[model samples]
Target: MSIHLENFKNNLKLRLDDNPQLHGFQTFKKTLERDYFSEVSIRICFKEAAKTENLVIEMDCNLDLLEMLYHLQKGTWGGNLSEEEDLPPNSSFARALDQLQELNEISIDVEEFSLFLNDCSIIVKKIYSNSIKDQLGSILSTIAEHYVYFTKGLSETPFEIYVPVFEDTIPENDYTLSKIREADNQTKDYFGFWGLYFDSEDDAVIYDLSNKSIVSGDLYLLNH
Candidate 1:
C-alpha cells in the first residue's frame, strides 16, 4: 500500500509530457481517492481573477475511499464480486469498476498498477497575459502542496494536496446566483462560484457556500 513517490513523480512527468495540452500548468490540488485503485479523475479549471489567470488541476476519486479502506481492514472487501449485484437498477455508471481485477499485485519494472486515469484529459484553453505569467512562480510557491506517499497498511486519512488559486475581484451581484445566498449563511455557505457556461440554459452548477460544495441542477433533482 506504500506509495512509490519517486516512481510516481517520474511516471507523472511522462503522463504530462504525453499530453501536450496540459503543459505549463502546476498542480492545484491532487488526491488519492478511495476508488483510487479503480478510477482516477483530473479536473482542469481555467480561472480568471482580475488580470491574473492560471490553469489549475484538481484530482479526486468518485467514491468514498475512507469507507472502502474501512471495509478492506475488516477483510470484507470483495463481497461484491458480481458486478450486477453491485449496480443500482438501470445504472451503468459502476460497470467499469472490476474490484477483483484491481486486487492483484503489480511488480516494479514489470507490471503496472491497476489504477488508471479515466478522466480523458479535461482541456481548458485559457490565454494568460504577461502579468499573469510573471506571477505564476510566486503564486505556486506560496501554496504548493504535494501529497504523494505510499502505505504498507491502510492510511487513516485520504491523501490530498491543494495549491491555492487567487481571484482579484470580490463576488459581485451581477448574476441572480449572487443574490441566492451568501457564504456565511447558517444553512448554506458558498465562498466562491463558477458558472459553467454552455450554449444551453438548462446546465447550471450551484454552490452551497457554507458547505463548500457544488451540486449540478440535473444531479440534484435526480438524487432528491
Candidate 2:
C-alpha cells in the first residue's frame, strides 16, 4: 500500500501549530520520491531570526520504514506470533528482514528489529551559538553511541546535529532533570527544551518548559 503522505503532513503540521515556541515559525516540506523508500523532509525556522543565523530544525521521515512498522503493529507483517503458530522461515517478513539488513549494512535479529521500530525519529538541529552547539554535540554524541538506532551529526556556522532525546531523559519533572544532570555531569543551562515529535497514538510534540521558564526546583509542562 502507498503511504498516506497528506495524513502524515497534516499530523506534523498540527503538532507544530500546537507548540507556543513554534507559534510564528515557518515550516517547509518536500517529498523525495525513491524506488525502495520515499523520504519526507520537514524544515522549521523561526521567523524572527536572521536568515544566516536562524535556528532550524529538520526531520526526515522514512515512509517505507514507517509503513513496515505500521504493518508489524497491525499483525500484517507477521509480528503477531502465537504459541501454536510460528512465523514461516521463508516468509515475506523474513525477506524484509534480510532486505533491511542489506540496506542498512547491519544485522538485526527479531528482538532487535522490534526495538528498532520503536525508535522513529532522526532529528537534525541547527542552533545559534557555538558554545551551546559544542556542548550539545558532546551530549548528543554520547547518547547516539549508547542507543543502537540513534544518530548524530555536527556542522559549523548554523550548528547542525542529530539529537534523539529518549523518553527517560526528557525532563518532565525536577527530579528527572536533576537525575539527568547528575548522570551527564551537566548543569540545567545545558538542557534546552525544544519541541519533539512523539510518533504514538497522540502524534503530538512533547512540549516542555523553555529554558527561561524553568525554576530552581520546579519543571513545568507547557502542554499535555
Candidate 3:
C-alpha cells in the first residue's frame, strides 16, 4: 500500500513514551513543539513561520544525512579533493532549506511542507543534494539577471536566496522558545535549537524511508 503524509502522529507519540532516553530530544519553536528519539535518529521541529505550523521531520537512517556530514567533516570530499559532498539519494533540497531556516528563527510550515504529520513515522523520502548549490546558485543568479530581457518588465528581477545560519555551535534549548532559556544553563549557547530526534528505525520510517536517515550539508568546509 502506498503511504501518504497523513498517517504518522500516534506512532510518533508512542515512540516518545516507550523510549526513556528520548526525553532528552524534546524541542520547541515559535509555532511547533514535540519530542524525539536521538537513537532512532529522527528530528521534528515546530515552526510558525509562513503563517502556518510546520512539523518538519527528517530521518538519518540507511542514508543518514549526519553520516555525510561526519564524513565531510573528516575530509572525505570526492572528485576535487575539496568541497563538501552532495546530499544522498532520496533527499529534498527544499526540505533541507526548511531545516536550516528554522535553526534559530521562528518556526514555519508553509508551501509544500504541511503533509508531514500523521499517525505513522515512516514515509518515502525525496532525494536531493546541495553539491548542486553552486550550480543552483549560478542558474538562479543568471535567471534574475536575464529576467528583464526575457519578461520585458512583466516579471520582477530574481533575487539571491540567503540560507540562515548560526555563528555559534548550539543553542540554549531544543524544545521551544518559551523553554529554551530555562532548559539548562549548561545546554545553553551550545546550538540547541528545537527539533525531534528519533533513534530507532521503526519509529522514523513508517512509510518506507529508513528511519535512521538524517541528511545534512557539510558543516565543515572541504579542502579540495
TM-score of every candidate relative to the true structure: 0.20, 0.26, 0.20
Per-model C-alpha lDDT, please?
0.24, 0.29, 0.25
Write one digit per residue (lDDT tens) for candidate 1, span 1-224. 11132332333331211221332111211112321233333332222332212222233333354443344334333223345454322111122222211332321010111211232111111112222222222221221111111111223222321111112222464343334432222211112332222222233333323333433431111000
lDDT per residue as tens, model 3, 1-224 = 11112232322232111221222223322112211112222333333332323233342223233332333233331112223545432123333444545563443331111112221122211112222222222222332333334222433211111111112122344322222222232312122221112333222111101222122221110100
Q: How much is 51 displaced in model 1, in angstroms?
A: 18
Candidate 2 regions exceeding 4 Å error are: 1-44, 49-52, 59-118, 122-128, 131-137, 148-224
Worst 10 residues of 2 by lDDT: 150-159
Question: Quick one: best lDDT, which candidate?
Answer: 2
User: Candidate 2: lDDT of 16?
Assistant: 24
Ranked by TM-score, the better of candidates 2 and 3 is 2
The candidate that achieves the highest TM-score relative to the unseen native structure: 2
User: Local error of candidate 1 at 169, Å?
Assistant: 14
Candidate 3 stretches with Cα past 4 Å from truth are 1-50, 63-69, 74-95, 98-181, 184-224
